[model samples]
Target: MKTMNYSPEHLTSNRHLFWIAAVLGVIMMAPVAWIIGLSLKDNAELLKGTEAVFAMPYTLVNYANILESSSVFGWFINSMIVAIGQTIGVLLLSSLAGYAFARLEFPFRKTLFIIVLFGLAVPEQAVIIARHQMFNWFDLHNTHIGLILPNLSSAFGVFLMTQFFRAIPKEIDEAAMLDNASTFRIFWKVLLPLTLPAQATLGIFTFLQAWNDYWWPLISATKADMYTLTIGIASSQTNFAQSEGLGFLGAQAVFASLPVVIVYIFFQRHIVTAVSGGAVK
Candidate 1:
């Protein structure tokens, strides 16, 4: 077989596209770089306007103030509880729901799944008003339980796991059945192993969602001590008769962003593999 070589024009066009993409990537990253830069700078420099914003050297005072004086650490712990709790909840509930939907026969199952899919389209923000009233009625407001309740059943998770479960071979189920395995036994012993990639994918997604969830936590949390990172970040900026300096606020932002970023950096490959595995086979 003979291979056809690219014309000079084609090579030039490809190079042009590469350079364009590189330029666009840099453009998109500008704000992230600026935020990171500002996080290391001092308030005296930040409030001094544009010239100071650029002129000030980076410092760790912002980090010190955030750690020493702020309630940031408490918020970090609160965020961990909510994020981990919600993630575990989603993994448990959604996997069971997804498995049942994919493998089991039941009445009105398709219709029920469709309704659940409809639930996906309902915006989280749109439901906050009613949810707040219900939370208050249940006396769940300002509690960690309240922050977690609204997240326990996740539509996206159900859908993702459902699709991935369907992709698994039914022959595996039949083989397990031939061995006299109960449905639950088969699921735990056989099917679940096949879906680890999907589980990881779901776990990461759920963690990120719950970790970064701002509005739900904000509405559900009112007590200063009950505050998660999102609520704490907002609260960090102001209180009765006091305002946090811009540098301190910048540090709060950096602190809030760091953990998630660290998780991504370390487990990025696993996340990618899991997602790709789920998507492919």
Candidate 2:
């Protein structure tokens, strides 16, 4: 096998690229670092100026206060339930719909898919009024089901899974059929396991979207007990102008983002694989 040559000019180019990437990485990470610094500083000190973040006397008082609040835990639980529920619902519905669209012959199959794709064009703002009215009519406001049901119809998830399923070879399905496997069995036992990368990518995104969602939850879950983390944190803020509240707000932002950060850290490999189109055999 031939080996790559490392000429002087090539080495210089490599060094330049490395420094460029380093600078960009630092640029992207600066804001996150700043937020973390703000979270650690005392609220009163932060009120003087954000420059206090660079000074000493950092403390955990903000985090302690967050822990002391009873409602924070409730909000955390609500967020977890909604995020996990939406992720599972999106995975199940999207995978099933994808399988049908990719493998099965049915009436209006293409037309139906086109209509579903149209959902991507329609912004949620346009439908929020109608959706709110319908939910109000059904008295679904302030309920977990109300919050979850709206996001379950994920057009992007369906599209991603459909493309992944289509990339799978037909021969696998044919061989499974020769074994007299039922259609559902083929999908569940044979094909589904092969789509783990896509599932991970989709699940992560769905969970993040659901967890960060604020607007729908703000209106749908008006009750304190039903508030998800986003709304709960916002409701907790007394005033942005107050110095004491600034640190707490920064702490809340950091606290709310921890789960998403942890999730990306754990499943980042699968995300890379999915984006790189390595999900299919």
Candidate 3:
């Protein structure tokens, strides 16, 4: 085979784009790395040497305090309950709704889908007052049940799944139907596995959103025991004051951010691939 050479313009364009991406990657990773570094340093070290950030002595005291002694574990469990529960809820319900919108012949599905799209723009903050009152009426305030209830369905999830569903080959559904597979089975056994990447993508997003949620949980949850890491870290600051509790605050913030970092490190490529495939289709 003969080698082919690119024009100077083409080579220049490719090089420019590659360097731009590299610069962006560095910019993004820098802050995250800095946060991790700060987390490792001791509180005294932190306060005595803000400018000596890179040179400070490191300790695991913060991590230990949050994970082992503080109410961090309780908050962790509560966050998991809301995050995973909401993620599963969104994936399951969204998958079914997505399949319906994509494959099933329904009346006014387009209008319904358009309405659902509005959920993407709807901020959780917008309806918090109403949501709080509703949870209060149901006696769910400060419970994990209350935390998970409000996020049970997501318009974004449904929209993402719907887009992915439309990309699946219609032939699979037809063949499944021919074998007497019910709608439920077809969605569960046939289509769902085919959409695994998208599911993972959605799951990661759902987990992050739930884990980082502060405002609703903060206001709705009146008790300290029900605190999430988002609120846990904040409460720690308020309890000790930011200047007084720099070490604990930094440590807790660092601790809270680790899971998401680990998750993205592992699942990032799958998410990118899934999203790319969805977009291409």
Candidate 4:
């Protein structure tokens, strides 16, 4: 067997890269570690600065207290409903629109596509006032439906799915059609599975956006019963003059992030692959 040799210069370069990565990793994790430490401290220990955060007498009572509070659970459920609902709605609507744009013949196809592309440049804040008025007119304010309606479609998702669908070979569509498959059958049974990576990528983005959404929900969900987790956690912090409240806020931050962290962990590979594939296409 032959042994490979690394030159002194190459070894030094590798060491530099390793140290750079280590530093970056530490920088990223520092805030998370601090939050964890803060969450463990009791109310009395919390005000003593960073030094006392990791000190003795760590307690889970902060988490317990929040969980026991009915509002937390209600907010958690509302967050889930809005996030899941918006993700599903975006996926369905974007996929259908994407497929039509990529594979179908329609009048004013270019004009319509340009219009869709125009939406990409429009900021959410630009239309928010109009959206609020529209929802109010529909009597959807202070409701979960109001929370979800604004995010039900995504321009980016439609663009992503369109690119993915366009990258797929036309032969597949022809073959399905030859077999007497209807358009919906071809889309559902043939094309859909092949676009899993794109779908997962889009789903993750849509879910995260909806989950972390605060401003829209703040304006829409005026009722306490309809508050999403982000709004609820933020509102809770106003009463955080007490040290225990600080620890509770830290705990709530960690709890709120867990779903998104788990989702990214599971779908990270697909996201990477889908993005790379799109770049190649």
Best by lDDT: 2
Which of candidates 2 and 4 is the stronger one according to TM-score? 4
Tell me how candidate 4 scores on lDDT.
Answer: 0.87
Q: Which ten residues in a row have the lowest lDDT in candidate 1?
A: 236-245
Model 1: per-residue Cα lDDT over 1-281, one tens digit each: 99877999989999999999999999998877776777777776666563455664779888887778647888999999999889888988988999999999999999999999998889988888998999999999878788887988888889888988899889999988999999999878888787777777788878888888887887789898899998888876665123566667777887888878988998797688866663436
lDDT of 3 by residue, 66-164 (tens): 766647778777777888888888888888888899888889999999999988889888998898888889899988888887886788788878888
TM-score of each: 0.90, 0.92, 0.85, 0.93
Ranking by lDDT: 2, 4, 1, 3
- Whichever of 1 and 3 has more lDDT, that candidate is 1
Better of 2 and 3 by lDDT: 2
For all candidates in order, the CA lDDT equals 0.83, 0.90, 0.80, 0.87
Compared with the true structure, what per-residue lDDT tens digits does model 2 show for residues 140-177? 99989999999999999888889989999999999999
Q: In candidate 4, residue 206 scores what lDDT?
A: 91
Tens digit of per-residue lDDT, candidate 4, span 79-158? 99999999999999989998999999999987888898889999989998999899989999988888988887688888
The global Cα lDDT (0 to 1) of model 2 is 0.90
The residue ranges of model 4 lying beyond 4 angstroms of the native Cα positions read: 1-5, 48-50, 274-281
Off by over 4 Å in 1: 1-4, 238-242, 270-280
Model 2 collision count: 0
Which candidate would rank higher by TM-score, 3 or 4? 4
